[model samples]
Target chain A: MNKIFFFLGKGGVGKTTLSASLAYYLREKNKTVYWASIDPAHNIYDLLSLPASPKVQKIEAGLWVEEIDVDRYLRRFLEHIQEKAQKVYQYLQILNLDKMFKVIKYTPAMEEYACLYALKEVFKKHEDKDYLIIDTPPTGLMLRIFSLPFVTELWLKELRHWREEILKRRQIVAHIKHVDFGPGAQLEFSKDKVFNELNAQQKDMQYLKDVFTNPKKTFLILVINPDKLSLLEGKRIVETLNKFGIPIKIVLLNKTGHSMELKELNFFNDLPQKKIPLFEGPFPKQVLLKIASLWVEDAYL
Target chain B: MVLKQIKDFLSQFGQGFKEASIDQIQRELEEMENAFALLICGSLSGMPAPPAFLSLCLLPYMERELKIMFSKTIFLDDKLAVWSDLVEL
Candidate 1:
């Protein structure tokens, strides 16, 4: 994709509406756009007053929208793991995988894993699109999603190292036995099933880390209302991205007309900022189409 | 019969002219395999397990180690009882 724009903010910060406006603008500019909401509390359909679709839907020419069912993605992710387990370890079927998955379903970071899975799918499938816009989940989950790749990479790397060492020792045993001791002894480090699995996971995590940390290909648009809490959360988002070396391209000061003190937002003074007028009710398509000029051109075009 | 027997002896020797059983190496190899299994799937025995997602796939490849673990656990539970049963009913 030419560019990936992630609209990130706390809940009720108009992430859905703002991202929709950017998607509309990009399509208006004749760029092929794929807009998706990875948030569980998706409001993209409501804001546009369009029917909710679990799959990607074409909206006129050069535009597609999807509201991802993250839970479905989670289930699919587990199925993928089970399928791999079957192929890599044939006897895996003896274990009641369904029961194990039921436990994994509630495991910490599974939601984040699901979101990462969905994100990779979108990137791979829609690479031909000129611009991809993702309306991210609220702050906590979205941050975790962005950082999941980096954290997972660290873990899988250590696992791979230990697996190689195990294989090395196994080879020593096979030498003395003059027989391949079960399956483990027969494996070279490169040829082992477990080592290969770990290698694949490491590669995927590194790819995601590259995508998130690359500033030119990916843009982080922080959406915050002109209020104390939103500004504080926005600052934290910026700081976290900085820690990851991922640049925040612009801060969209949403709901500007409200009398929330701007003094709190001095944190954003160093970065690019754009103001969008506070509207009274549901965002009309006409208004979204018009507001595109306010920040889309300045921030993206 | 003498010629056939000589041929058979030669074939057996040729098949593993380099093969030899070494007890020390055998024991060390067994130890490595057991440790590998214990580290990866330790959670099955109420030990601190690796993240299930990461280790779940390797269950089949570690089948030998797992069996060893179970046998060892059983033996540890009542070694004397197991030996007494050797007398037969």
Candidate 2:
């Protein structure tokens, strides 16, 4: 079984419900489950009938639930950068980091970075779990989150190269002038503080990249409604995921009805497909458990 | 005595050449630093930059370069020079 499962779909397509049900299902099988909602429009807590603000809470003997507090997580991410910066910058105390951060929080793509950082942290923290279920954001943002590591890795490579070139030049000049070029010049490029920090970030990104692309370790389950719009979005998501080398293990047709003709759509032909019946009432834990019982045994098999 | 003079002149020439090369390299490095700062923190100047969270992550290591970039005078008349630097990069 894949160690990690990501539930992805359009908004209001029952991704949270299906993912929560899967977590509950896994718990019944005596598997350790860590279920997290990484979507900005978080609904996992609401679906599970728990308080919304809990970062991580015990659901049962082996299942844990978390609704990521994005604001707090973003602040923690900034704090992480600040701590690393203090170690790297000799005069970090002089910089008005708070003021700078106030400006930075409004910049484009900051939310995406924060989301990715939080996801990475959550994934790292629960590596020992038998199953890690992620309820991702809506299609567009979730795709961006998945693609972030690739873009980040590319930029980091270029940045590392540029940094090394600059350092090499500095060392050469120091040698010619017979001057001590400071501690940075004395150390190998990998040991240089700036290089080391970039390297650390690269390592984190690479770990995620590997996990995301490896099918045996990670399974992407696309949750879709039987409606046309959801199917369209799911198609695009599947294509993008394929382009990024993330294997889509299953296409979940949620809120499915007797119009079995929707199953014949060409988009669903490529992957394993499962249909979920339309439920009439609120999806409480009991309802989810009943729904889960249908597929828990053979869902991944 | 003549040989000694030649030797002294050669040493001075070598020192001057080294100084000039260092100066040119420093200028090139400075230009690269400015471009890099703009790549990350261009939002500060109303130019589109990479994600602020990432820029913030890199800002600590780039404090010195950014300071130089911010302090350097911007000249409207230096369009050609700016073009050349961008082309070189």
Candidate 3:
């Protein structure tokens, strides 16, 4: 079973650095690890001194890394719909829906969907790896992506119910009219394309929801600076994830001042905190590996 | 010409009779379709839309419902447009 570690917090909080460190640390432990940067602004390649490429590259014996091309994911997501739409909606050609395919990239929550698409692709492709370290975007976008599955799953359930009702009414209308609406007329859930699509989407959403909220499989690590603004965002992240039943396993207080107390921040008190002292960096591979070793030793991973 | 007119009248009458046989249920079915479309493509009506990635897949199966939706909206200015007949068209 591949365990996933997601590193996220407010912007400029060293998420990429910390996630890269963890990926390195895990690889050192002889675990096969895939490091994915889901952030729109990627830093893993530059930080790792590896040439920047969206394609996954093997940096060493056991590590694979990619800065996910998020827009490509968005394109793929839309293209699947456009392809299906062109096929199933052959009679609707006059509506000129090609514009819709181009325009839907600007849809609300589209960035989150793209990020989720990237994450899902990683999960499907890298299931054989031992550990998957996800380097995520900032607080707002990450929260939406995290909540997308749970919220949409609930909506899908409602859609399924309504679809059943619609199908039953179709049966009634068909019977009363002595008309054959055909086997695919949605008289049954099994033969209905809409219903089956709804079910498949719901199942995918539920799978993601379960994996996100499941502690044993996923470690939700929050990295925050010891600043007031970052802590405020961190508090909201914790509250929102709690609302969705995703428990944070650890808090990495990166670039901390001399000494800070979790007791001072009540929301972060329950979480296991690893205080990392501020370090000046022009971090080479050796320096980064050293930092990873230090953080790994006390993080209780 | 007289015979053709009678044929048209009988065709309209037969269509009306078929509709009258299940008028209430027929209306309920229409309502169901509109509801399904609103839920699936709520963005069209300024309603909170479902996730586009998921809903787009359902659009291929929504020709009937979507036509009902558009017929109403496209004729919103015409109060006597008889949108139900438009649905038949």
The numbered model that scores best in TM-score is: 3
In candidate 3, which residue ranges exceed 4 Å CA deviation? A180-184, A258-264, A297-301, B1-21, B72-89
Candidate 1's C-alpha runs over 4 A off are A83-95, A260-263, A298-301, B1-52, B57-65, B68-89
Candidate 2: tens digits of C-alpha lDDT, residues B1-89:
99999999999999888888886776676677667777777777878555566677776677656665765546446778866875575
TM-score of each: 0.83, 0.86, 0.87
What value does the lDDT take at residue A300 in candidate 2?
Answer: 76
* Candidate 3 collision pairs: none
lDDT of 1 at B43: 62
Q: Given candidate 2, what's the lDDT at residue A219? A: 83
Candidates sorted by DockQ, best first: 3, 2, 1
Tens digits of lDDT, candidate 1, A90-124: 65467777787888788777788888888998898
Residue-wise lDDT of candidate 3 within A1-301, one digit each (tens)?
7799999799988888788778777877898999888888888888877779979999989999999999998988778777877776676658677787778888888889888878887898999999899988888999999999987887898899988888888887877676665333567778888889898888788888878988888998898888878888999999999999999988888898844654436778788888777767666656667767656763445
Error of 3 at B86 (Å): 14
lDDT of each: 0.78, 0.78, 0.81
Fnat for each predicted structure, in order: 0.29, 0.42, 0.60
Residue A126 C-alpha lDDT in model 2: 90
